[model samples]
Target: MAAVTDAAGNPWFSWDYVQSNASALLAALIQHVELTAASVLIAAVLAIPLGILAYRVSWLTGPILALSSVLYTIPSLGLFAVLAPFLGLYASTVVIGLVLYALLVIVRNTLTGLNQVPVEIRDAARGMGYGKLGLLTRIELPLSLPSIMTGLRIATVSTVAMVTVGSVVGGYGGFGELILEGFRNNFYKAQIMTATIATVLLALVFDLVLALLGRLATPWSRRRAS
Candidate 1:
């Protein structure tokens, strides 16, 4: 295919570039979604319990949030480098790092949501002979649905962005790889723009899906708003 360049003599986005790399782009898109989903799921599993514990034991809250905050501060590439020896260049390294980054948002929001439950509600549940588990599952979790959903949405969007960083760790193909390859191949603008746009679209799509799920989960909130 003939190269497409702008009047400024610089390569620009073209359908030809997209058509040629359709297979690779599709593979990368799938990889990005899989990585983001896996990371968030793992994070939720680990975070929810910790969040509960942090809520029950006030002293644990500070430390738990602190640890996650520190983990979040680690540079993405640096974290990958640290994990490479133990996990090799596999996707596990990326997933683990993403999970760590997501923990702060998930755990904090979980705690916030649970704490937001009215004291009267808790007392009522207790008066009705609800055990601790019942109180948590039926009373707290349902009320906290909105907050937890917010956390999930935030984590999902952030994870989608971070997964691109994983492309730096060879063998972990994602949209980031396309961006990097584009830069490496003399600023192949078409590849770069396509991958970047695809990544943004993915994040927006996930955010919207989560928002819809949140609405479904907490219909009472919508009812109140209306």
Candidate 2:
């Protein structure tokens, strides 16, 4: 590894390093994004439904929340280590951990959103002859878009940060690989800084994109906000 510092021995950002390692960096970033997106998407699919189930059945709420909380309390590295045995250090090991970690946020937010729907709104919907399904799909979901999307943005950022732990498992770590490799090579400043910057930027970009989508999905909220 080249001195992260230039010939003068001062720590410096190296354009040459970026130029030389562009492909590897790009690959790391892409993997990071893919893993984050996949984990969040899967978590949402599971959590949203579980959240609804919890909402509909008060008796189910305690177990569902407790289970997700327990899964989340397991440390990331420990979770990854336990899963790697069964999943074989593949992306799946890391992804499953991420999904589990994400469930708490998504599920809680989803349930909160649905639960917050005004009683008057439900009564009005019922007066119009809307059934439970119709009320949920038509009234509750649309009103809950903001909360659900907020949970998504939070989960996405958190997942991007945690994905680094996957490095211990293998190439599944994305930019984490860069950070780990840089550390292994005597604290390669350029490599580490580059990876750190890319990771932060990725999280910001995802949050922005999700915010835009949420805004578009809830035009009523947008108008009210304005």
Candidate 3:
């Protein structure tokens, strides 16, 4: 392939490069989606219970939130390096790191939403003979759906962006790999632009889908707004 350059002598964008790497791009896109989904779901499972416990035990809340906040602050590359010794360069390292990163958002939002439920509402439920389980499942959870969905939306979008960084873990395929490859082969500006655009588009699409799902789950919120 002849190198195409602009008048400024920089490599110009080429659709041919994107066409040539279409299969790799598709594979990377699928892997990226899978990694994001798995990490978020796993984080939710672990975080929701911790969130509930934190909300119930006032003393524990500070420590729990602190730990998750610290985890979130860890640099992504540094976290991957730390995990590599134990988990190697496998996708699991990426997924586990991402899950930890997601915990702060999920747990904080869960607690916030649950705690926001009015004390009067809880008392009213009890007055009507609602048991502890009934109060949680029927009342608190429903009212907190909006907050939980917001957390999920945030987590999902962030995870999608982060998954690209996982390409550094070796054997991991994501748009990040394409970006790195383009940088390594500086002539391939098309590769860099394609990956960058695709990553942003992926984040936007997932965020919108999650927002729509949030709306569906909390129809009462929409009704109230209208």
Write model 2 residue lDDT over 1-226, tens digit each, in one string.
5435767664546777888999999899899999999999999999999999999999999999999999989999888888888889788888888999999999999999999999999999999999999999999988988999999999999999999888989999999999999989988878888898899999999999999999889999878888
lDDT (tens digit, per residue) of candidate 3 on 20-58: 888989988988888999999999999988988898789
lDDT of 2 at 59: 100
Clashing residue pairs in candidate 2 are none
lDDT of 1 by residue, 1-226 (tens): 4557888765667788788889999999989999999999999999999999999899999999999889989998899888888888898888998999999999999999999999999999999999999999999999998999999999999999999889777857589999999999998788888899899999999999999999988999999999
Error of 1 at 37 (Å): 0.6
Better of 1 and 3 by lDDT: 1
At residue 74, give the lDDT of candidate 3. Answer: 99
TM-score of each: 0.95, 0.95, 0.93
Weakest ten-residue segment in model 3 by summed lDDT = 2-11
Q: Weakest 10 consecutive residues, lDDT, candidate 2?
A: 1-10
lDDT of 1 at 172: 75
By lDDT, rank the candidates, best first. Answer: 2, 1, 3
TM-score of 3: 0.93
* lDDT for residue 148 in candidate 3, whole number 0-100: 87
